[model samples]
Target: MIEVSKGIYWVGAIDWEIRDFHGYATPKGTTYNAYLIVDEKVALVDTVKEPFRDELLSRVGEIVDPAKIDYVIVNHLERDHFGSFAQVMDVAKNAKVYASGRGKKGIEEVYGERWDVTAVKTGDTLGLGKRTLRFVETPMLHWPDSMFTYVEPDRVLISSDAFGQHVAGSQRFDREADPHALMEDAKTYYANILMPFGTLIQGLLAKVPSLNLAPEIIAPDHGLIWTKPGTIIDAYGRWSKFEARDKVVIAYDTMWESTGKMAHLIARGAIDGGVEVKLFHLRKSPYSEAVTEIQDAKAFIIGSPTLNNGLFPTVGGFLYYLKGLKPKHKIATAFGSYGWMGGAVKEIVARLKEMELELAEPALDLRYPVTKQQEQECIEFGRKIAKQVKEAKQ
Candidate 1:
């Protein structure tokens, strides 16, 4: 945890979660987040999970007298929110804990320890000396315990997890590092981390707009703080809308590299036309993650050499995942390295149809040991997509 602003600091844990990169079904390296405050009356916004309770306390101790902290506001009750709850109060005995009415119930379930917890509803306001914090109940903004706390005067939004990336580090603000990687991480965070609550997210977007609240800085519980504000808010709005990128996502599962050759050719063409592309070898990529990469691509293309009388088994899995996502504003095509058994291309095309992807004209399917003509066809396919990309942009 590090301080990013005067009287403000990040108390979140770096994701050292084992296999975090692989994902949740597997061992997920997750960021256990928390925050601290130093106002006229010191307060701590949230606490880390239990394993880092002591660390949370020490961080809070860095600025002021923990005992003098007037409040410990609980944002959400996933142990991540209150794992350090007890230890924090152990140090700040006289502090008042604030949370939503339902959020308080959650805190109590594990709060077995005694403490002063005040439950407030929407529109509740807390006076923290020179600054005022407004609590906005954002139920199901991913979780029931979820809420958005806005600190007026400073124009800071202490959002727990929202607009946050699953970044692992002690860097408190984004300006300190590379913006591109962090932004991608933030996008992946939205697509994968917050995927399940789309409707609620849309509602939050509508509601927050009515508040006319645009923070100059958005301080989330995880990842770097947004000192430049709209950089992340704009991103959140675009991502939540499932905006499509003018790029192609190439997913392929090749039996003997023939289908892979076709995929490479198509990618070259798309790149030549200035369409960005992400190539994921299905055998080497997880279906769940591939779906994420495909989420916003302007086009999706899959290739699989015939196997078991149909598309490769992995290609089928990827298709199923894509179908569940029901992506929008995308074109789809099928290509493959087929031998005597050329059914894979047809099967993939049919599956893509089931996913509701608008078909791009003339799906390409190549036979084993492509001749010069086949490679040229691949380049043509790329060039076609590139043209479409530019036309779409226009």
Candidate 2:
């Protein structure tokens, strides 16, 4: 067990083999992190998934008996974080449960009211002799019941899900992990899970500074803890604002080689026009990974071949996922190939429009095998888009 503070130990389990999390790919696995603080009243920050309850209990047992636990904090009511709450309370029967008002209601809705949970609001503090535990409500920072627990004296914020990554490893802090990979996972997490709540995140960030809570460390529910809180706080500020770079992402799926060839030619034109680009075959690449690329890109170009009267199933799935993510301040366009009925490009265009992205151009479609003239047209279309991206106001 890693000691984050003098009296606080990380008592969480790492899922080394989990390949997927809530439908998102978790190739690197993840950690269901919880913290144990030994003060006048022993407090548990959070708990693990239901399957990992034994692991959490074992870790907590190393420092103190489970019966000694006096308080259990529920930062978020999601199953991943709250699945083992019942088990913890069952063992530490004397421990009083604490959660935000909404969190308490959500927990009751899911697990019934066998145990009495004290509902707290923003700015509420619980004294534990030497240190103070303060609650901050963060609704829709991914979930309505999400809240942050600030442990004073230690100056640590037990941030629930915010500023977290799906990384399972021996390291317990961001400094111990590969910074590049950790940041990449953090970006992917933000893109897939938290992008839709951009406004709420921004509001949370602005609210934190005014509270004057200078957190020295940020302990999140997943991934390594952030010892240097400034790094992640700065990142959240930028990401919450939907700040993007001068890059384009071209995502597409192909049946034969027609649509694939167009994707390559278009990528080539964008490169020749001095615009940074990322190209991914949706079926080959994880949709979550593509969403990560799209997060900070100024433009997205989609290509798919028509199947029956609609988009390719893989393409449709990717678009559906991307649309739900609600990427903002992006320009989009579509290109595809069809055999008899040309409908894929139109459908892709409509999906991008539904996402509220600025339509960079009308959809481009080709019948059967793409001709040399059509390839050239695709190239010009890419160049035109590059010009638009270059001229876009930062």
Candidate 3:
């Protein structure tokens, strides 16, 4: 166990073997962070996943007896945070559980009404001698039951999932991890998991300042603790506003070589047009990674080869995933090659429109094997997108 603050310790588990979280990829795995705040009344904030119950308890046992925990704070009721609830409550038999109103209801619904739980709201405070724990209801900051616990006098904010990364390592704080790598992991986590709730995040960020929560340290439920809270908070501010850089993202899947050729030529034009370009073959790369690149990109161009008069399976699936994310303020267009009949490009354009992305150009489609002339058209297509991206940035 590592001491995060003077008396508060990190009693969490590292899941280095997990390569995937639901559908989001976790190449470096992740950590389920739980904080143990030792004061006049010992309070254990959050718990690890069910599989890591032994590791979590072992760390807590080192500081104090598991049964001695006086209060259990449920920051979030999601399975990853609450999976070991039964085991923890079993050990800390006399500990009182405190959670957001929705969190308490969710806990009761899932585990029944056997345990003693107190429903809390925003502005609620619990005193433990020198430190005071303040609750802030942050619904849909990713989850409805999500909340943050601010430890006053210590100036630490135990954030549920906000400002978190899906990374696991021996390091316990941002200072110990490579700055660039840590931020990239945090970006990927945000793109895949929290992209749909940008507006809510903006509101939360504004609320934090007004509530006078000037946290010196921000401890999230995943990844490392943020010693420099402003770094992540600044990034979150830009992201929550859907801010974009002068970059273009091209993603496609080809049945043969036709669509692949178009993607490469388009990428070349975008590169030559003086903007950053990220190209992805959906079948070969993880969708999570492509989404991360698109998160801050000014424009997105998608290509697909028709199969049985419909979108290529990979492209269609990617669009479905992208639609759910609801990426905003992006310039998007579609292109494809078809045999006999053309329908894939139209479907792609429709989906893009459904997501409310601005269409940069009319959907481009070429027949069967793309000729030399059609290839130049693809190059021009990329150049046009690059121009749009640059113009948007200006």
- Give candidate 1 regions above 4 Å deviation: 1-5, 16-33, 65-70, 79-96, 105-119, 194-206, 242-245, 272-274, 283-296, 309-326, 337-355, 365-373
Off by over 4 Å in 2: none
Per-residue accuracy of model 1 over 6-124 as CA lDDT, tens digit each = 67666666556545443322123456566666778776788887887766667666666667888888888767667777877877888888998888888777755377778888778
lDDT of 2 at 353: 79
True-structure Cα RMSD, model 1: 4.0
Clashes within 3 Å, all models in order = 3, 0, 0
Q: Which pairs of residues collide in model 1? A: 17-29, 20-29, 269-382
Q: Of 2 and 3, which scores higher on lDDT?
A: 3
Global CA lDDT computed for model 2: 0.89
lDDT of 2 by residue, 111-215 (tens): 788778999988899988798899988877778888899999889999999999998998999888888888898898988899998888888788776876789
CA RMSD, predictions in order: 4.0, 1.1, 0.9
Q: Rank the candidates by TM-score, best first.
A: 3, 2, 1
Against the reference, the lDDT scores of all candidates come to: 0.76, 0.89, 0.92
Candidate 3's error at 171, in angstroms?
Answer: 0.5
Q: Tell me each candidate's TM-score.
A: 0.79, 0.98, 0.99
